[model samples]
Target: MDTLIFVLFLYVLLTIPVFVLLMLFAVLTRSARLRRAAEVVSLSACAALLVLTFERAFEKPLLWIVVVLLVAVLAFGVSTIVKAARERP
Candidate 1:
């Protein structure tokens, strides 16, 4: 569990900066591909952080909230990825 948490923490830490940079580049260049990449990265980072939180506080009432949020984020991520794939040239 400790190792899992550490890995997730590291993933979030690394992806967040990449997400931010992708978003900035997308905005500057008006690139849809970059924007979608940024969205995926952001969602992945959010889900990782949420999982880390959920693991650390599994016994808390807040666990339910985290679970709900994690589900929502994952669902949204899947839907967006599918949509992007369908729209690909």
Candidate 2:
């Protein structure tokens, strides 16, 4: 379990920059596909973060902030995906 948590932490750390780059490209290119990809990366990252937090049993106040941020990111990703779907022909 500790190994899994550590791996997830690493995954989240690695994806942060990728996610930012994806979002930047999505915005610059004005592509729905890029936007969707960025959201998917964000959603996965959120899931990883959530798992990490849960594995630690929410032992720290800092983890509470992580939980809040994860919830917000999940909400944002869902909303963006839904909106993109609705916009698609």
Candidate 3:
């Protein structure tokens, strides 16, 4: 129980930055599709984060999977922002 709480605390901490960066990209880019896609994904991630918060048992290695997914999302946003900047008129 305590362990799950700690993991969730960390997840929430990590989620904030990822969400912020995604939101920034959505706001800066003129692509409505990109913004909509990002919003859906990020919101779903938040829902998953909530589910993980109450988990009392699981393979410990799942934490690594969670971190990887979060990082991948952040990396995708970074790539999108870079591409948008380069392609701007």
Best by TM-score: 1
Residue-level lDDT of model 1, residues 20-89, one tens digit each, is 8999999999998899899888888888887877776767876778788788888988897899799888
Model 2: per-residue Cα lDDT over 1-89, one tens digit each: 77888899999998899989998999999987887787788799889988888656557666777777778888887887888788878
Decoy 3 TM-score against native: 0.40
lDDT of 2: 0.83
What's the C-alpha lDDT at position 7 in model 1?
Answer: 90
| Candidate 1 vs. true structure, TM-score | 0.78
Sorted on TM-score, best first, the list reads: 1, 2, 3
lDDT of 2 at 77: 79
Tens digit per residue, CA lDDT, model 3, 7-73: 7667666767776776778789866656656665565555556456325225565576665665666
In model 1, which regions exceed 4 Å deviation? none
Q: Would you list the C-alpha lDDT of every candidate in the order shown?
A: 0.85, 0.83, 0.63
Per-residue error at 79 for model 2, in Å?
4.5
Q: How far off is residue 49 in model 3, in Å?
A: 7.0
